[model samples]
Target chain A: MDKPKKSALIQKDGVSISEITNKNSIENLKNKRKSEMDPNELVDSILNKDITALSRAITLIESKNPKHLKAANTILKGCLPHANKSVRIGITGIPGVGKSSFIETFGNHLTKLGKRVAVLAIDPSSSVSRGSILGDKTRMEDLVKNDNAYIRPSASGDSLGGVARKTRETITLCEAAGFNIIIIETVGVGQSETTVHSMVDFFLLLKLAGAGDELQGIKRGIIEMADLIAINKADGDNLKAAKLAKTEFTRALHLYPKKSSNWNPKVTVCSATENTGIDKIWSMVLDYVEITTKNAYFIKKRNEQNKYWLLQTIETQLKFYFFNQPKIKKELKNQLQLIENNKTTPFAAADYLLNL
Target chain B: MDKPKKSALIQKDGVSISEITNKNSIENLKNKRKSEMDPNELVDSILNKDITALSRAITLIESKNPKHLKAANTILKGCLPHANKSVRIGITGIPGVGKSSFIETFGNHLTKLGKRVAVLAIDPSSSVSRGSILGDKTRMEDLVKNDNAYIRPSASGDSLGGVARKTRETITLCEAAGFNIIIIETVGVGQSETTVHSMVDFFLLLKLAGAGDELQGIKRGIIEMADLIAINKADGDNLKAAKLAKTEFTRALHLYPKKSSNWNPKVTVCSATENTGIDKIWSMVLDYVEITTKNAYFIKKRNEQNKYWLLQTIETQLKFYFFNQPKIKKELKNQLQLIENNKTTPFAAADYLLNL
Candidate 1:
């Protein structure tokens, strides 16, 4: 409850907050959160379905501040026992494919079915520049305004993938808070698709009718990972084109062997604007769950993904830390400049940096 | 020089018997204009313009054995002073695009122009399965039969790109042996393509006609790196298609902003089988050298590539050595298994192994 008392207690438990906090401002934020209650108490509040505590817990988990990591780790431990209850779905699509519109329509449909839907949408417009693209919550006002749905725009930080990691931890936090269904609508298409795919149970790839060869231009690796490919915007004149695209997609999809071994990828047509075929998509997703769960592949896959995320996280952090080392930073920059000047090369610069 | 004296002198210089033996074999095979001598003495005898010593030096450089590496390195140091004065040309295409046919026509044309040409090709074949797709030298019997042209297939032990590295080092040896042009051929589609690209002064991408929209499927990154995209197999009815592909390729090349400051990728049509446009292609390559050389970008890029190869070599060797440390190998394998089975992550496994 008190600052020094809590600090002492935290220190006694071998988490002195030194490894988690560096700057005064971050420490103040952590201390403020600590003053409100014990770290375990906040976690307990989250378990009671307190959305505010759940959100705060996620922020703690995501913080770069040294002191927060220890607290966040403990919070994660507390939340783990209460997590993994909800169905998690990942939605990815290229730009201008109406991803926001689809998520809003689909979120409304879920709420209408008497399910509490939480949308962990990662769209950081300010951080990542976009042109001719929809990348904000304003585009999904209907869903954001809904009582049963919670939509959070991406928080600014490192990679969109890093943002996705926080969103994933938040998904667990939300799941522990008894959210029935979690939808992680990626920023768009391939960039965040792989990151989002590593954490969710079902992956949905959205496409417009006229994608044509552009689909191949986008990564084949992501397309191969997709569980379902939905030709979005299947309303009006687009319907004919959507059906044609669906056939083309079916042809392309045949090239990839069945991904899940026990499950076959499905191709579907939907009009997100009209909110038609949303229920069918949900039903199909549940069918996947049914099959994968029966084969015990669901947990096995999630565990694999968790390990992948952990490795990716550590690799990224170590690389960042290694590059930022005082002894390496300036010399590394110099070597990079040498490479840019064609005096050395990217491989040589990497070697020099790592060896140093 | 007798065997015992030569052996004593070579041993004193810290050179292995195998290095001397490999070089001696090449000496014995040489159709000399002058006198016959002991193969061991022949290597030291032809210090001025010895194609045989050059061949043996390349053989040592290509060997995977540690002793071979040391001996090759020493030989390379010795050859460096008299290394290649030739322009290195790397040609890549997918399988069945007539690489051999193209090289045969091109090399013969060079030999007719009174230039001694060397055709060093890398075929992705294994020694265990020794038969090469283009094993029969009769495919290029014209070039092979030419006294002015030397043809060597990829050696049996290593990867294609590896064969290229060996060939590159050998190119220096060949140039010293008075071969003015070195052509390294591979499919533009494999990992070998990029590897070959880094080692050569010019990278030529050969494409087939009627590639159509399939051309779009080729990776933009790889395409952007090409200095020339030749619409090969441009004979017969395919001529119209080839011309069309050339136009399309030119258009695609325009879409890419100028790369490497000076190089603007050129699009041309050629038929390796018809022997048409082959000479023109060579002239275009000469023009490229003329332009890039006047601008000094040629040798600059080569210097950068040298640094890259050095760094790449070091990094790979470091990774191999670190992972193979006798005490840590078992633990590393165990951790890798745990990572594969989802018990831990690759990052953690790496960290654990490093600590161990």
Candidate 2:
């Protein structure tokens, strides 16, 4: 497809082939642009690490324009073989844990290694408010401006459940765009945390060292799930308390069963502000990938997480679709009446309404 | 309605009504039991606080015997007027909170004050593997021996949420039976807690003082919904820790804007084990009821809860029914297959299946 024809096609995104056929004046238009790109050209631009093309490509996939989606998928297919192979890390912590600042420092560290890094953050608070602050891009300005680094703030929409309608697909797009070392940052280790954790290769939990008492510690469930627990903000007056917290956390971690990775969950202290200790953390992660990948466990982990997302997404959709049926819409009211009047138990009412 | 006819109906439980209606012939066979009590007599015995009659009346409702259910409903009708007049308290904590022991001590206190107490405990877990443990009778032996006390475990079934399905209905039965105070005991504040809370005037959250930190104390959402937070096991050395927990909770409570009740939430320290401060807790609850009832909030709340249950039950059944639709069932497999292959997003797949 040539530039001029592509520009014209972009302007009229909805003109399908059937529509084009009806309008013979644009006969050569389909041949000129074709609504699909050469896979080799896509790979060339992506390998050059063109962030603009990557952004536009991701936008195309997200768009409802069927032609644009087809073009985007074609681009992704062409870029597939050349896509960068990098570690996909998932980061999560409770609110007030300075997630953005930490990610900025972490991304900067990765970029310094001559590696291309992509940060995909899904902020829970953003999904609710329609317009998320997109603060991470602003926070990681230096990293974002770096030639090898890409930062895309969460897509603003109503899609919840850590993995959005476009998130997993977006991950694929990011990979095809030749970026390696993908870091998925999610705020809060609650429901949304579960979402990111299922997508990433290694899950890291960050905890604030609040006065170091055993009373102030991460939740047991979240802690147990972590591949590594990093005590964030280990500087100044917090230094002593952070040490105490590290000791307590190490003891508590020992009580949990060994992980499938055969690597015990390690705890470390890091100061994102000071840019200290990030190298050690990176080394630890590298060790995890090396061990797991060699043993064939890394691929198994990805496959399992993929399986979970497939099942979870399907179940959620089924629930949404099931409640919106027309016949059910009518039967529900009659059944509620019967239930209220004691004519039927709720379970039997459910049974009857289901039959209807 | 008479003795011989009722006996014949009872004997041929699953038999046709024709067998029960052969009254003229059956009358001659059981003329001797005419000396036993009639419906009015049984009702009178239950009203006069006869424990055995109350038990039998509840059994009648549980039984499918037409004569017994008819008698039970009639007895319930008489109790309806008296039911709402009692303080319905729902107590729930984690399992192994010594719930039965707590209720026993609490019940004994009420009975000693000449209050007629009725215990309706619903154990959802017990319904499947074991019969429901009507622990009040077994544990509160002193109170059980009282003529004015009634003890019944959940007979409803798997979903304690079916909750005393007849529970609210049976409150009338117990009330008609002359028990002025109703105590509903559940395993804990969880999915079932919301169900029990809907049925009671006051919902109490009992906590093991040192078991959880303030942050870990049931998510803020549940805490905000709580009317009163009582720090149980506040006796002995745990008292200091409990006090700290109370302070932490009090602070956390403030984070939730003042509730619509116009009443500030209060946290109390108590040891249900030593039976200490039981009266104080009751006084606090009575004050809540008095103020809310006098302000006309009580009835409105009950009405809202009933409406909520009706809607929730309807929605749940609607989902179940729609998914089980023959056409929907056949297409779900294909749509899910598309979703698994990434041909369509889960949302899009659901939309297609639902449209079909």
Candidate 3:
């Protein structure tokens, strides 16, 4: 078969393919220009509260270039002391639950209180396609150009571990740049929420009221991990329904075992668009931080999380190294075959590999 | 700081410690004599339904003796075909929830229908000191004396992994002995319930009515894993409370995401002491099996479990070997110190170790 004409093949809605290609190329060049900076200079500029330098450092951390590894580490080390001074919060909800609007409203509220707010996202799927819904700046129209708010889209990468690592490092950079409140937003998808939950001090789960189908798709484990659940879009027609949902969620929360942190998980109603009940949620977060800090659980939990990340990183790297080795990979295949055939026990195979 | 006399130091209650020690020695000698048979002899004897031989085979599997390793593997291979024909069930509940009585009633119900039943326990805490409450066979008086029922206490081992492995192997031996029903019981104190749930075809959680304190201790993860939750000891004064609890639980379960297995978790009330609802519970199990078998989920789940255990066993053994090495252990301690001091990133430490 003869190939179709290049113009006809790539044409969509009568626009030429080269026009789209050139536009994307120009955007890529602009991003490339924005990220060009030495590690030491980047750190100095970020500490001086230069947002451009902070953004460049985050891009450096997310880069896969082998040369960027050392630079990323250097910038991260310089930012460590300034980090952890902020109250980091994780916000999550399924798609169509108004996560972007909620963040925009909540972030605007924080900025109104003279707080510098930084919003980051942990979306693993974006790593694959680089076309994440949140990648569009227009999604959060109100907060896009706010001087006190910094909204960064999810970093693009191939693996969740890589994305998570970059996001964690970016948090420190944001903190060092004088951001007092860092809000890590993630869509309630797979393991991304859990990853965000671990890195944040307070985890807020957003939900829409009067959606029975919503309850059936939300895992109980996620609900149990939530520190606060807000019934969102609680305005006009959704007012009574949101109140009813709030009561139902409160009863459900009562059944969960009390958290070791001794903080009760709360459920409240909110209207992000209308900006109702936003202050109550902020006060709830403040109350939690005050109580947990007074009891020393705040420091204890952060210390434990730090240790956990260390062990987790080591475990993941060790497995990756082991499986990536040519000899070990071949042996692993053989061992799995043996296990499938029940010719040798899993323990015996593992023993043989360890000895080798 | 002088020590007391040896006899007085070890004495408990009114009995001298030496007398108890001598009695235990005699019992050990008897058990040693019983387990001295060869691998082939033990397999033949177990296949012939000799309870003593079956017990000895299980002991061989649980033994740390190097000599028992080959024999255990040989016996397990011989029994592989006989396993997978039985329906394995997992039962769990917090202490004081009448787990013993519930199992006794349920076991009797199956045996009365001409099915031989095998009961095993996975108590990691018992392995630490062998003083677990389930270590007492006297607690299950009814099942202990029943000819068609075999009750085995938790295997005494140092870790949950060791106990889980032994219990899994014991299931095969019981199947070879022609027991068509196998019930693995665990306490819902920690991760043991999850381990047992992974190995069983059906998981049942026991609870007492009118005990809000009970709900406060039971983790939501455990409830989410339960195929059925039974409100036990629901008789006379507790009947109304049990009914109310059942309604509450059912409502709570409705909010959870439906399981991929397409089975909705069921909540019911029962009186193990009065032997009420025993048949109904058995019927529920039968119904589950019937439906899952027709949909091929029964075999699919078991096959998936088999593969899961194989991978899990390998992963556990690999970690154990890596951590137990003197060189690795020393280096790990040093790396952990560096992590605590914030002198090294987790990825950097892990990379160094992997290269080593």
* Alpha carbon deviation, residue B57, candidate 3 (Å): 2.6
lDDT of each: 0.70, 0.68, 0.82
lDDT of each residue in A233-320, candidate 3, tens digit only: 9999989999999998898888877998899999999999999999999999999999999999887776676666766776676667
Segments of candidate 3 deviating more than 4 angstroms: A1-36, A124-133, A156-158, A207-224, A229-269, A287-296, A325-342, B1-30, B34-36, B65-70, B127-133, B207-220, B229-270, B290-295, B324-342
Error of 3 at A340 (Å): 4.8
User: Could you give candidate 1's fraction of true interface contacts?
Assistant: 0.07
lDDT of 1 by residue, A216-326 (tens): 345566667788999999999889999998898787777665666478888999998887778889899989999999999998887677667654654455455555668
Candidate 1 overall Cα lDDT vs. reference?
A: 0.70
Give the Å shift of residue B274 in candidate 1: 0.7
- Pick out the ten consecutive residues of candidate 1 chain B with the lowest summed lDDT: B33-42
- All candidates in order of TM-score, best leading: 3, 1, 2
Per-model TM against the reference: 0.75, 0.70, 0.82
Worst 10 residues of 2 chain A by lDDT: A211-220
Better of 1 and 3 by lDDT: 3
Of candidates 3 and 1, the better by DockQ: 3
